[model samples]
Target: MPTPRPRPSRRRLLLQAGAAAAVQVVVRPAAAQEPPALATLVAQFAGPQKVREGRVKLEIAQMVDNGNVVPMRVTVESPMTEADHVTEIAVFNEKNPQRDVARFQLGPRSGKADVATRIRLATSQQLVALARMNDGTVWSDSVDVIVITAACLETTTSS
Candidate 1:
């Protein structure tokens, strides 16, 4: 084998390191930004409505054994009449990469004010349910979930 090439000079190595660090600093913000929290998501959708409790029921396990798919159900007390039906139900996860899990739009034809679905939880956090009534009012409820094993990708940090 040919003689090993001489190691890079200290000055050149330091310059290369500085360049690499600068590139990382430039690229980090875009790749590391997270989505808005649950409360912010609700505010964005509802636009200044007072969120009231007790009118809606959010059924989710207090502790989820798996985070890939957690069962969730939401029910609202509403007459399924043309004038007062629950028109929409939105599910949000407070700690997920994306806050809004899903939104189901209903109408008088749905004949009920309830919905059930499975959602992905990023971590142990609160899940919120928002119900929009046919009469232009919104109601909400929230429940906490304890996640023993995280399912979502861990947030990457560069030091």
Candidate 2:
């Protein structure tokens, strides 16, 4: 006759293993998020085709006292005719919470391909303006502006 040995309970086994195992809590530094570049955002709209560097003018101050409301003007060289005109105009930024700031849709009937508005910038960076013509050609221009007071500033609380 042979004697059988009893198996330990699942709770008892976990308790015994817990005593020998070491628990560690690792804290990792939060990675800062960076916005995409102007080129990257333009490619998203016009693809990787070559964009002409002229015909589009970006009028903005070289230095801005406040980024909350920076005046901007975008004018494209076009006849504004039904045959040849500016189809779309887009504004982009290098460093901001959002890469694409504004987009305006226009046509020959709009009288002109010029747009004037205000935009918010997080910091001093390059501002790009792109225009898509009716001929399927894309034109662009950029301006570098220094912002004294940045927008989109957030307040963080420590735990």
In model 2, the clashing pairs are none
Tens digit per residue, CA lDDT, model 2, 33-52: 32457667887767656788
Which candidate tops lDDT? 2
Q: Candidate 2, which segments miss by more than 4 Å at Cα?
A: 1-36, 155-159
Structure candidate 1, residue pairs in collision: none
Report the Cα lDDT for residue 135, model 2: 82
Candidate 2: lDDT of 57? Answer: 98
Model 1 / residue 72 / CA error / Å:
0.7
Residues 1-159, model 1: lDDT tens digits = 899899999999978976874665465464433235655788876776776666689999987768888888999898788878888898888777777788999988888888888888877777888898877788988876777567876668999
Off by more than 4 A, model 1: 1-36, 154-159
Candidate of highest TM-score: 2
What TM-score does candidate 1 reach? Answer: 0.72
Q: Score residue 111 of candidate 2 by CA lDDT.
A: 96
Each prediction's Cα lDDT score?
0.79, 0.83
